[model samples]
Target: MTTKVLLASADERTLERLSQVLAEADAIELVQVVREAANVEDALTRHPDVDVLVVDELIDSGRGLGVARTVGAANPLLGIVMLVDQAGPEQFAAAMESGARSVLSRTSSLAEVVSRLESVAHWVGAARSAVSADARSGRAGRVVAVAGAKGGVGASAVALLMAQSLVSSRTVGLVDFDLQSGDLAAYLGVHTRRSVVDLVDIAGEMTGRILRETSYDVPGGIRLLSAPNDGERGEEMTARAARSVVNALRYQYEVSIIDVGSHLTEATAAVLEEADVAVLVVTPDLPALRAARRTLAMWERLVVRQRSAVRVLLNRQHRRNEVTESLAAKIVESRVDATVPDGGSPFESAMNTASVAAASGPAHTAAAKFAAAVVGPVDDGPVDAVEEAYAEVAGRGRRRARGNDAGQSAVELPVAFAVALMVLLLAGQGLVWGTGYLLARNAAHEGARTVGLQAWGPSTPGAARADALDELSGRWRSAATVDVSPSDVTVHVVAPTVVPGVRLTSSVSAPVQREH
Candidate 1:
């Protein structure tokens, strides 16, 4: 089919040039020619069959780029091209950000313009076809908002893994919506030249072609729309832009995973509004649980989505007795849908290699499998996906610690008993050891005084030593010794171990009494 084209240029000479180029091009027909950017949209409405829009940089009384951006956002499926002379890197970047599918130099030959138009037209057609197919099959895309119940719960990482798993059998769009500080590019090992910041200006025009230009490929067939490395740049994405971009992805891909970072914001909230499922990743700890509970309550109060739409994924779970699945669900006031084993070693390796931990190696297979199971093998389409996604783990709720006194004491009775037993054992040992030490020390002092008496000599020292041994007459008595001299006497005693393998020693000395 011949490609229908529209030309918008306030400059009469520029219009003549574009018209002449189009007339000479094969398989391209000039359908509408508007000399003003302000009149561009009306022309599109009149010529609804127009396939491509070629806008000159000088149109709209120097607001040509603004018009292009506006038009692109409203008609995302429409092909857009920016014609400029000597577009530097900055200008080219700006042009792309304004939603131009192709930016060509105004001085380019007719052949080059024809080739560019053909390429842009082809991509536009493909994008429209995909959306049409999605409509015909009643398969609106699934959107998963991976939101952290609290910071450092591995929500971003889980989001990435979910996308990776989903894309294994389907097309997935993984958007890094963590505007302030997202590292999706680093995680995917992608040195991205563009980011979501670039798409904000033309978010309304977020067609498949725009996604292709903004995203990078990662290891798991996931297309990543990286967040701005510069936090300040991230401020450019408004809530409307977020909604537009996410909505387009919802229509284009089978599944779209948005990394909403560990906390919430207007930008992230915009994405979450479209989520069929908000996988709230929380660590299995009391602090994280408390934070998650607060966050859930906030979500409910805000009425962002139904509480049922929120899926509680307790990540990095271990064998610790502190935070069980039942306990976490009770605390968070939500069902614990799934648990991901803390594959610490493999996780480190994956992050180092900038690959997905679940798909890194054999060691990470379990993590990968768990990710797949949670995200699901079933496709999310032809209906709302969250309900089905959650059905797998919803009803398996174990009874919470509920009863009089919250059943807390009953549940912890065993643990409390164990701890009490340990404390008693230690305190008992200390008492016995203290008693043994005091007795031994007293016995040694008594013996030293007895041997130091004027009438006592080396021969009589045995009697005193016996008296000292009799002071305890227990295991500690086995190693008592007394030394006598002309002027003084000394007694040494080895205190027996109160607790096994623990021994203490004591010694005492006294001046001998003499006639002088």
Candidate 2:
């Protein structure tokens, strides 16, 4: 019998395009085109004969993976392929961990799509044959969870960059589990109307038809299953639903990187249980360190019992008052896994301009080092004395803040200054009126005047010649002048310049103030 394939996507165009591509393959049959699973239970109930299920990375109802898991759970023998915009190694790895049979990028050529479909079909066929030959073999794939101990630890940034870094050698899928306030799509520079929430309602009946309608493909072949930007839907996910999603992704990609949000929600905990490696991200600050310590303790009490792997990463290591790696390790009661340096002014400038790829200088290098550490040896280098001193200062600062919260408030005052400046600038343009021009002109004139004065000697006839000219010009301009002696005096333009459209100008004299 010809292999029955179901295509699910958010875009009708994508569905039509993919349907057309699959139609060209003689061995595959386009069985269905669904925008989403029409209730996870029902979708599986209705499509019992679907040999292969193709889904978009983003499904409606924030439950695309739930649909995949539902299908996979109901029919373990079924083959599943996820259509992603980009297929980075980390994301592909995550997808495989989620239970996907294969993953294809939407940006890939029609030929590539066909090839991927054929490959998935072949794999499914071969796996069935292999199962008969050896029924006791373990599954191959790794799920890595990138989680922040607290908010603003840059966990998502690390996860996405790590996923992008892995694309060269591995197939990866990036799952944004933040549900609410998830910025994966924005970070990846992808805009899609449909998110995982849209898939939940129809997740039950999701065939290939439903999966094709929702996912957006990104560049470099990394598949992103983004969360709804609306924080309201965060509670929409249940632990069971989250696990379903993760399971579905496992079949399609070899590795999966889940950006677990700050809080260890039940849904996230479900994912953590399945993850092979859990990367706990934190900064060098006291609050972050405390949170990391608590989180580590909690995980040790909970998921660590299951033998789930965990690693800690320190981000923004170059801050002037940051805790030393040694102190940070001691606080967490574990050795520091890796340190990501702060990508200075240029890096932040690129991020401000919304050019993540351009801002990826230090972040890229740090990500490579981090990847190497995760995959290789844990480098335990000696702590620098300077770093220890800084850590001592940081610890004192934390203690002071804890005592009275005064230092914390004081530290936040500068941020207020920045906000106030931004508000003033935005509210009125005249706030900085002539500011740039005045600074530029003052610098230029100061340089020129210094050169001119150095060329003339004090008490010399040439100096007198210059001073007399200056006195005459000052008198002409009616500027306040004080005589040094016979010729020179310092002139001050107390009022606005008399010249048309000119501003204030002031002068200081040395020996020329009392010229002989």
Candidate 3:
């Protein structure tokens, strides 16, 4: 467990002092000492086992921090401690931004320097051990890359929920690989101090512990590696860094969902290269489909990923969308894997609340299906964890929408009637109400099913709801209201009782059948 140290300083006196101090410290081995910033790289190359790099503030004609950045990028596992004349806030921030893990004043006592070295050594030791353990396990997780044809296409939502859905059976990692202008942190309502940029430097030695340290452990069993809040720092995540980070994620988590954002860059292209399942999210519109085609072609020409390897997902699609899935697939020259119905208000509300699980209605259902498509299908034996989570939240919301009237009857019968007569009337009313609820629910499902079965022409939701209502009895039809969409149908029935204004309401939702 000895920590190998490399000492780099332009000042002879500083170098001698630090080398002698580190060499004398227990469990610290001074493997290399260099007097120039330029020579540090060679020293590290010669001593690959070196864990810590102690650099002076003015090395190689005042390029000390520059050298720190270079070596840090080259050897991510190498702990960096910068020695400066003044360890002020500015100096410390500069050192950290340059990839130095810690900052120390040259005037500090040897004891303080040793304490700092040991602290850094502990982190490096744990990180290296985690990496070693992961390598030994020989486990590689699946990578799913989600790219948007254009902005505002709900690609980020898809990526976020996709990760959410997989958490039932596996450890999922959601990476905001968009680098510049990435908003996963904002979407999740989390502000992470460390980001993907932190891992870009240490990606080669990334482990579960390191990933956890640099990522925000979300509430629902997801680890999110956010993009840099400062958009300018995104340039640090180069193609090589992206590849290394994605590979390390694969070794650490059971599944990783990468949101590559709308614009494709070298870093994002690197992610696409590592993806086992690559999807381009596009709305059912001519402009989006054209953009998707161009993006696929660019990916092909750049040799980042093959066009055929990418699957197209239609977002914000309507039953009578101008661009059909088949037409869009033909336009993009890729298979349209699935379509997500326009979620309308509930979906928007969930996004605003930063809770994907709170989303109800057709959008949530479609998101679960999309996750299943990417990560394999969900079993029918039991309630799926993702679906169950959504349903639970939706149920709570619905309950809140209704008053706390549990254990109370919807209608109160008069005490003036005979007991037997009242019981019989109440029983009859209950039967009628129950029958009406069932009929309305069945009609809603029928509406969705009929809309899905249409192939020859566009089937509007209005027509579908009307046709389904026609199948119900006149009494039930008069009291039922229906709403239909490509993803599902919802129906609400108000069963009237003998007393005026005394009624019972029942709402039901069913999935809309469609051609897969």
Candidate 4:
């Protein structure tokens, strides 16, 4: 059978090179060629039977790999091969995460290119055949990774609550990928010795039975996969193992929620790359906003995910917070998709009692709505009604609070006025003192200049003193004193300020220039 191939590249030289090379191959037929990322989808639509897609890494302004990721997710059975300028571990990992079956350098020999093309074609054929035979084949589950911008941002709580919110409508699996500081199990008040680390070695061949044995059945029908108790054991779950585990989880559940904690690691990178929705949880503060930006930048640099693809969720949102949804979005350069309000005491008590399932407050309701908004289309009928009802009650409380504050303001206004008046008077008095100091310093300098001159300057010590005193004017002339000494050739000036008995003084000395 001839293997159909689609070649996509914006570079004409690359297109000519690939076309020439592919023309010599007898078994491989180039069915379609697309120059832009936007046109690749249409080309695929035209040629649905194409077995392998070979894409230039620099196509579509260097978003070719991201395009591949979108295409692979839509057509999981299709085979993809990325043509990179340089092929290394980083590029290979990025390609794999993008759903490409293989990555090859653009400079690969004709024989190597043909061989890889054939190999990917063979795998695609086998995969399609297997899916055709299996009656249980269905759409894989959606994976949502909840990552904190910094520690204490409540990523674990959000993950658990989101899972709990989703379990009512879908099968939800919650995994603690925090490694050293994972507390998903403790959050639910459950103890389990087995964790995800136990299945790392066998993740590739993970079965439903094996997963059941390793996972715990927590409240609200959430499948809980706890992290290892020992932090050192986290190293055993490598990136490869993390990817395999995610695949298995996707196959088994309708929705998998992984709390990747605040820190990024090898394993978390794999999880983040695999997640369908990567939600970054951040507080409405400057430091948390900065951390969120840094985290998104790191993901982009590593090619783990695109910055535009990340959803930023604002936690601890309050009416009085200086940072709003629009402001935060501006700061992070991403849209603020959803927000969880401050839950107050009821929310805190629920976590303390290990009864998050029973937590009922504005925050809990908002969290559920946030999960719905992030995961799938939200039904806003009931959500709007709930919000309206909360707003009305909150409105009445706000009015009462304003009334209480009015009384306090009445007492504070007089004190504020008095303080302002005192500050203005002190400022004017300081200005007068500064003028006195300047006058005294100028008189001293004038007298000193006269001592160093011979013919043109003041002739005697008394004349020098008069020159120094003349520098002062207004009230300063009578209040100020100037002294000149011919023996030491020193001059001094003193002046009184607006403040009674407080004086400003200056002194200067110059060598006497006697006739040589």
Candidate 1: the clashing residue pairs are 73-204, 73-205
Find the 10 residues in a row with the least total lDDT in model 1. 395-404
lDDT of each: 0.71, 0.63, 0.76, 0.77
Runs with alpha carbons beyond 4 Å of true place in candidate 4: 1-138, 377-516
In model 1, how large is the Cα lDDT of residue 348? 71
Write the candidate numbers in order of decreasing TM-score. Answer: 4, 1, 3, 2
Span of 10 residues, lowest total lDDT, candidate 3: 379-388
Backbone atom clashes (below 3 Å) for every candidate: 2, 95, 0, 0
Query: How many angstroms is residue 383 displaced in model 4 relative to the true structure, after the best TM-score fit?
Result: 31
TM-scores of all models?
0.50, 0.47, 0.49, 0.50
- Please tell me which model should have the higher TM-score, number 2 or number 4: 4
Candidate 2 weakest lDDT stretch, 10 residues: 430-439
In angstroms, how far off is 468's CA in candidate 1? Answer: 99
In candidate 2, which residue ranges exceed 4 Å CA deviation?
Answer: 1-73, 76-139, 201-213, 304-308, 372-516
lDDT by residue (9-119, candidate 4, tens digit) is 999988888889999999999998899888886687688899999988899899888788667645667889999988899998778656688998878888988999999
Which lDDT tens digits does candidate 3 get at residues 1-516? 687888888798887777777767788888877887767766876787888889887987888887887677556667899999989999987886566779988877778887888888776664455344434433457789999998888899888877877787887999998888889887788878888988765655454546766888788888899998899998888886788788778757778999999888888988898888898999988888899999989989999888878888899899877788899889988888888889887778778888765445787678778888777653323422223333444466455535444545545322222453555556546544544554565566567656777752455777778766754643567778887767777888876665677868777666655766
Pitting candidate 1 against candidate 2, the one with the higher lDDT is 1
Kindly list the per-residue Cα lDDT of model 2 for residues 1-516, writing each as its tens digit. Answer: 477788777788788788777878777788678886754334544666666888777877555665665566445556788777788887676565455767888777767876787776665554454333321222233578888989998888888778777766666778888877778888777887777666666543332223334666678767777888787887888776666566655544556788988888888888888776789888988899889888888987875423235778898888575589889988877667888887778766755554664345877788877765564432233232223333444566556545553555666866755675554443222211222222222222222333344434465444433333332211223543333333333333333322367444444332222212
- C-alpha RMSD between model 4 and the true structure: 36.9
User: In model 1, where do residues sit more than 4 Å from their true spots?
Assistant: 1-73, 76-136, 357-516
